[model samples]
Target: MISMNCFELFIQTYFTQLQVLDISRACAGEYINGFRWEQLISTSIQHLRIFALQISFKTNDPLMRENTIQQFQSPFWQEKQWFFICSSYSIMFDSYINLYSINPYRKKYYLLGNENTTEIDSMPFVVQLDIQCENV
Candidate 1:
């Protein structure tokens, strides 16, 4: 298992090189324990997409998921884009399946709620962005 500091270093060093990073099979315990939202906003990579699946281990209580969702929906991140996918099983486990994206000139956010009952698929949950950039 990668230590928290190492994970932070890895993200800092490598996230810029990646256009998309998928960690669908990995558990959330490692990430939630070490991840700070502030750290993500500070990355040098101005554009990236992160897909995390089966990561509900952070939501131990009924309110936890809602709180996290609230943070995701917060307008404070008007410059960033985020997507979320919460599985029924993960709702019980408190693991979250979500995506984070960053772009300087455009933003998109998607929310997948508790309505879908399909079994988790091997395909990584992804949000396709159709951005039309305009020159400033």
Candidate 2:
């Protein structure tokens, strides 16, 4: 098994060729801050892949989520496989509200103009933007 840092590196280097990748605790705190990361992977003695990256704090912040989505939803990232997982409890709360409101019985009582409800509806757009950024 490789160390966390090295695993992150390997993912970056060979992400395109990889059919599967699992990462944990590699980018915890630093995930919110901008940083550079690299990865190298070898599929065989003669086959190697390398990827170098400078991560931007462009999409991780809640305040900038809408803007980030607008920027990344362009024609870029159309062909890459990407995933993003957010640990923000507040976002999860918003998602829960969204789900609750979606129930036919609940929708009748919830105010149509509620801000939190609106934000919950917008979460999928925000997530799609993050994915586009990673893939792009």
**Alpha-carbon RMSD of each model:** 12.9, 17.6
Candidate 1 residues lying further than 4 Å off, grouped into runs, are 1-4, 26-35, 49-54, 76-78, 87-136
Model 2 misplaced regions, further than 4 Å: 1-7, 12-16, 22-62, 67-74, 81-136
| Candidate 2 lDDT, 1-136, residue by residue in tens | 2334654553444333332222212223333221222112222111212111222332244644343333323332122222222222344334210000011111112122212333332221111010111221
Best by TM-score: 1
Q: 124 in model 1: Cα distance from truth in Å?
A: 24
Candidate 2 colliding pairs, count: 2
What value of lDDT does candidate 2 attain over all alpha carbons?
0.26
Q: What TM-score, to 2 decimals, does candidate 2 have? A: 0.24
TM-score of every candidate: 0.46, 0.24
Scored by lDDT, the top model is 1
Count of backbone clashes, every candidate in sequence: 7, 2
